[model samples]
Target: MLLGRHPCWRQNPAFPAIKASTFRLRRLPSSNPSLRFAAGDREPRSFAAEEMGKPKQYWLLKTEPGEWSWDDQVASDGGVAEWDGVKNKQAQKNLKSMRLRDLCLFYHSGAKARRVVGVVEVARQWYEEGDGGHGGGGDGAVDVRVVGEMRRHVELAELKGDGALKGFALLRQPRLSVVPVAADVWERICELGGGYEGDGGDADDGDGEG
Candidate 1:
């Protein structure tokens, strides 16, 4: 959740110890033509849904409540914000893999009441930050739009206690800011969050926070 320096980055050997200035700049295609990948230093990773033979994927994005709360994201322009300042290499890779319209759970970590507070959609794909140069420092930035808030927040305690969520990445890799969510897990979490109302002529139920 801490933008500038992540404590996990220091402890995780998987992350490379490279300076921000060393990253090279390259332009990559984006759903939004105006937005392009800021740094082309790394090998190109395809985020096309067809290439992966998958439908819309789900993700979980963790942020400290104090630094960037659900309300803060909802208040941003068009209920969207540039999810930037990610320093961890794995997290950066996750950002690169995101495709437009991908739904994400907005989890509030490091809060007195840590929980999944809301949902967001990827509005734009990867792009550079600020001046969009090699020295700009923001190598990973994804535009996310707030889809809706959770009708009832799902606590981490509940997730850990649920047997169905035993293999969830959040529990295995607590420090990872961005994590992929399995389709079934996504549906289960949505139900737990009071967002999913089962099919049974209950679609009119005010379950979704939006």
Candidate 2:
């Protein structure tokens, strides 16, 4: 579903307003001396303009395993599906904001717990569904493709228990379906996600997997 670029997005006016949450990172007491980011000089990776403004962007998607499983998304072509069934006004607005080619994280919510298990790409823009289509009161949705599963799951318990992520939105607003992850937060997650490992001489080998 593609929404023509909103005039407000260009002017950067705040239309859909939301409250802010605080997050902080702290080192965990671990014997694994190879985790170098623990010293705290690492910064999160920021999306370059070339990386942004594309038809797609990165997002975190949450769903209960009983309703939709990671395998369900993988079963679809390119893992694309019209993301619908949203009732929350804020969540709907976030869906409307997504662009094509955006990347998304597969988060399993509910009793199984919140964990980023995989990655997905936006294949379509905001489009209206139901009989009314784009012009009427129909709800909004987007097509997403599952790109790859996270090599390891970043569990909510692990995140909340981590000192560094003390201020993470996942900790503050557990109910928010769509939230922004700061550059720092992104890096920290990637690190915890196991993006960095195997530096040859590095001790401990970093064999943890999700």
RMSD, one per candidate, in order: 23.4, 23.3
lDDT (tens digit, per residue) of candidate 2 on 111-171 = 8567887777777878876743211233767778777777678998888877887787667
Please give the TM-score that candidate 1 achieves against the real structure: 0.67
Question: Candidate 1's error at 18, in angstroms?
Answer: 78
Q: Candidate 2: which stretches are off by over 4 Å?
A: 1-57, 131-138, 196-210
What is candidate 1's lDDT per residue for 99-124, written digit by digit as tens?
89899999999949579988899999
| CA shift of 144, model 1, Å | 0.2
Q: Per model, how many backbone clashes are there?
A: 1, 21
Alpha carbon lDDT of each predicted model: 0.81, 0.66
TM for every model, in the order presented, reads: 0.67, 0.60
* Model 2 global lDDT (CA atoms, 0 to 1): 0.66
